[model samples]
Target: MADEATFTQLKDKVVEVRHYIHQHPELSDQEFETTKYITNYLTKLGYRIITPEKLNTGVIAEIGQGKPVVGLRSDIDALPIKEATGLPYASVNDGVMHACGHDFHITSLLGAAEVLAQEKDSLKGTIRLVFQPAEETHVGAQEVDAAGGADGIDAIIGFHNKPDLGVGEIGLLPGGLMAAVDQFKVTFKGIGTHAAMPQFGKDPIIALSGTVNAIQTIVSRNENPQKTAVVSITHIEGGSTWNVLPEEAWFEGTVRTFDGEARKTAKKRFYEIVNGQAASYGVDVEIEWIEGPDVVDNDPQLTKWVVDETSKHLTVVKPEPSNAGEDFAYFSQKIPSVFAFVGSHGNSDWHHSDLRLDDEGLIPGVKWYYYNAKRLLAELGKE
Candidate 1:
């Protein structure tokens, strides 16, 4: 084990920061308070801070100087879920909560920032700490990247809090860490008539039902047996009353896939199925597709470095790829990156109304960040 005293001190700081953030959760692009807090903290640590023109709520702090700069990232946005953890430091904002453990991630990165700053004289190269916003909707990383966040970054590292794993364990996946997500909205229009005169009117509700059923076949029958694809119809709205035959029906849902080809194939098939089914039902249909984040692909060399270096501080495990998506995929696309998971030690699922995380897990996470930064700096020194 590492020195208990130093680790405990860092844990204490993590608790303070985490609670502070939990008590003041902000949503997506509106993270003014969160950004201010991070900016103030990092500035106090003697690091130069850069505020990009486009991203008002993002903060990038740099320490040390030289080639092959490494980057550390943390998302500062909170979900819209209401706080139900009942902790004293629970969110004061109604209908908003830190359900995703972003509070802990920011705290861990801040902890690393403090340690790295303190040891800058003994370190080599640079470390860029990014405090990002709007990760819940998977747009923050792209915004940051567009603003030249990783202009000359050699490697970017990030971590999510995993409630399924026990505390003190870090999970790293080499290849696909998370799937790509896409959302779609479809509407069918038809003639409306009395419910009793079904033969006289074309009901869009009927077409919607067929559309939903056929969309499922994209995953079950159309997709390859070895590949994973998810096509879910999460919402459907048609008739307002039982006595009326609705003129129009709307449905929306999301699709998730690991590979780009699978994602494209699923999207193409979805549009075809919806249009074909609507045409057969003699209804006019409109489909809108919105592309989302891509898969979180970890660079093999950087992932290996993370695994090897993290092993020196705590127990580490390789986890399977997750279906959920993250905005960190944007950073991974630009530079070498590895997004790992730090154990949260709770049973509650993420984005749930009652999600909670073990506060003690912050200790190991802080240590992991500290060691990872040190190892990166050391590696840069050798080059």
Candidate 2:
């Protein structure tokens, strides 16, 4: 634990950094400036930096040395939402905003780095910090993992801000905390004809509409009743004019599931249903399936350790599982890891343009990151 003066100074710095990041937000896979800012700060702290070749963005830095390396990760990308909070430091990057509280993520992790650096020589084992990019697109963790960012890491930990919980609270769930995410895009092609002459041509809209209804069954009907799953058709685009049927129609959506069997069933049925509907409508169909992050399954032992230890410093609560997808699932798949939900006490939930996060959450966030890293390093060192 840090002294009051030190904690106060660290908290001030965290808020400063958070507001700076909130104002100059960048989108996923395009976080060049964010990466540079993180790299510069870590470099000044005398941490060893690892540059990933496959990824254009993201930063990995480390302090201390020896065995039992503990990894701490934070996503540094913003969403494509326009700011509506009207804060003094609202986003200046026109269509981009850190609506997901990533500004808080980046700041708290950096705060941990600053505090840890002062005691780097006395620390036991290494502490690796990963400032990941493209989490919104669900590719950053895989990219970082492929680039060996998780190499030599014994255990890892991460967190997301929960607007529902009050400040000073932390939510923990041992198994299957977040759902798996998969995406698909379908295109239907048919002859264009006047709306009045429906019999003259095959309508792609009919095929698109049918496919949308069919995919819903993939969750409600195909998936086992005991399991959890969701199939959402986010957007559909087809005709430009009301009178003429469009020659082509396309729709894209996402699938979320917590069970592996449920996830597999959903994908298999999605393809079969889409193709079946297109054939029935006499329209040509094209399908594109993209595999996103898997379910964020927390290691039971690691989660227990985190809760038992952090409860001494912060309030820990058991919360319901989230259907939201997290790319940190990739790291959890490879190493023993625990993902926490820190209370931000925001006015609105994540990804909302009007979301307003209380800055008081920033102090607890910095404490969570700094304390968790120290405790993990200490425990792992014992083994």
Candidate 3:
């Protein structure tokens, strides 16, 4: 943890940074101004700034040199949602808002930066503070890694603000905390014909309907019921007019699963259903699979180290497995990493413009960041 002086400094500056960031929010892969602001802040603190051209936008600052450097990541990009919070600090940028509490995330890391920079002289190892962009689209972590953000880093730690839990509480899961996500789209192509001539042409709509129904069996009839999996069709598009059939019909959705075997099986079966249905209907089927992050298999040792130290300073809860996917999964896959959630209970859910979390409520998260960093660095030396 930070010294008393450093702690006090962080405690005082947390709200100011959060409020400013909340007002001037930026979108993913386009955090130009936000990058400039954070760069200036870290530069003034005397940390060596590392923003490679490939990173596009984001800042990687290093303090205290040597082996076993720890990487800390916080996604800085905002979402494209109009603000409706009515708070004076609500998003000033129209059609862009930090609806997911990324503003709070940036503030917490900035606060941690203040504490770390103040005590760097007495620290044992390096702390690489990474402010990542494009997390909403799940490409920020990849961008950072491409920019060598994790090069030579011994381990990493990151956290998110949780709105369901009460203030001062944290949620940490040890294994399979979140699922792997796969989004897919299928287009059924057929000859368009007038509605009156029912037998004139193959109807892609009939084929699409059959395909969607059969795909659902991937989770039910095809896969083992004992395992967890999900297949949902969220969007479908077809003919524009009532009496005329369109030449193409398209549908898209996502699949979520905790079991790797189940995930593969689901995709394999989905393709089978689409192909079989298209063949029977004499239609052409085109499919695309957009692979996202895999299951968040939290490193057991790293998670234990975090919980052991964090439980001392704050209330830590064992969270149930979630289906929500995170790009941080990419980092955890490469190095020993732990993704945690800090309580910032609000009246509305995340991704909603009406979301609200008091600045005072997120202080424990700030303090936890310092504690986790110190403990991880200290533990690395013992190994």
Candidate 4:
């Protein structure tokens, strides 16, 4: 409900809040200090805070009353990377960093809340502010949704900071904008042997080595090339000494897919390849599959509403699908939801320690959160 000039006036305050939060970054599911800071700020803005005991971290704040409640969510967790930005507001908590730009996410939400709270009396319906935790681990949204966060909410809107496009440029995608993320860990067990030994014992390194090559075929040979999917092995641990093979070998990785069938096919082929390799090498194998967030499938109606509402304030553009998984998809799975990307024109990619973005980027982000909620209230209240 706040006009452009009103939001612009609060720009300095938003940047200040962002700096403080960035300096004291906290990891997922353990954001006690971050929660306290957000609670204090929201309370100071005259908004009522609801502390759900079910939610370990984060708080839900309410403004206004009546029907057609819309929830605006912001992820409040950081990563395990160390700060290398060397900026004045770099993380004071060593080994914990806001490389994902969650600091901006939190600050922008509060900026929107500050303006919304001032115009609450004239607003048509309620606006719920969700400060979510453990987003990096992809479990926070489920907890929030289960704790009745989406109990009465009709629609939910969320946004992330993206590189390439400058401030005020918003990225929009109608359906399946992000891939479904699944995790896997496989361990191969065999008898240890000397490097020079040819027949002394069974070797797990040979089994795991062959299995890695075989897993690649799941995408190249098994799945449809037309569809989007990727399987990447990120971590591997095997062998203790350079000249000796260890009895155990383990590797973990992630799979990304846009289609449900593709995801299933990839997982099926993955297990088959591991099993075949295990049998051939005469070694025991164990596999663990961890399900992550589903595809970020935006509601057609909600997506259209976001484009219409955002076009009134800034340029709206279409962006390609992203492989990076987002927990916001969990919110979309529960209700009619729209997830957006606000460009920051940063030099480094997300999750990098050298990430850099201008503080001015938070201005448009603030207006986005403010206008999205206010416009949703207006449109939904009419129905």
TM-score of 2: 0.93
lDDT of 3 by residue, 1-383 (tens): 35656656666678888889999999999999999999999999888997777888999999997977998889899999999999988888999999999888888888888778888888889999989999889989988998898798898988888888788888897877778899999999999999888588889999999988888788879888888899999999999999987789999999999878999999899888899999999999999999998877778998999999889888999876678888888888898888888888877878997998867666777777888888989999888
Per-residue CA lDDT of model 1 for 1-383, tens digit only, reads: 23667677777678888999989999999999998899999989998897688887879889988776889999999998888888889899999999998998999888878777777776678889988889998889888888887688888889999999889999996888899999999999999999999998998999999889988999887788788888888998988998999899999999999888899889989988999999999999999999999989998877888899988778898887789989899998778888999999976878986778898899888887778877776766676
Q: How many residue pairs collide in each prediction?
A: 0, 0, 0, 0
Candidate 4 weakest lDDT stretch, 10 residues: 1-10
Model 2: CA > 4 A from native: 1-5, 53-55
**TM-score, one value per model:** 0.96, 0.93, 0.96, 0.96
Worst 10 residues of 3 by lDDT: 1-10
- Maximum-lDDT candidate: 2
RMSD of each: 1.7, 2.0, 1.5, 1.5
lDDT of 1 at 43: 88
> Using alpha carbons, what is the TM-score of model 3?
0.96
Candidate 2 least-lDDT 10 residues:
1-10
Off by over 4 Å in 1: 1-4, 380-383
- What TM value does model 4 have? 0.96
Report the lDDT of model 2 for residue 113. Answer: 90
Arrange candidates by TM-score, descending: 3, 1, 4, 2
Residue pair clashes in candidate 3: none
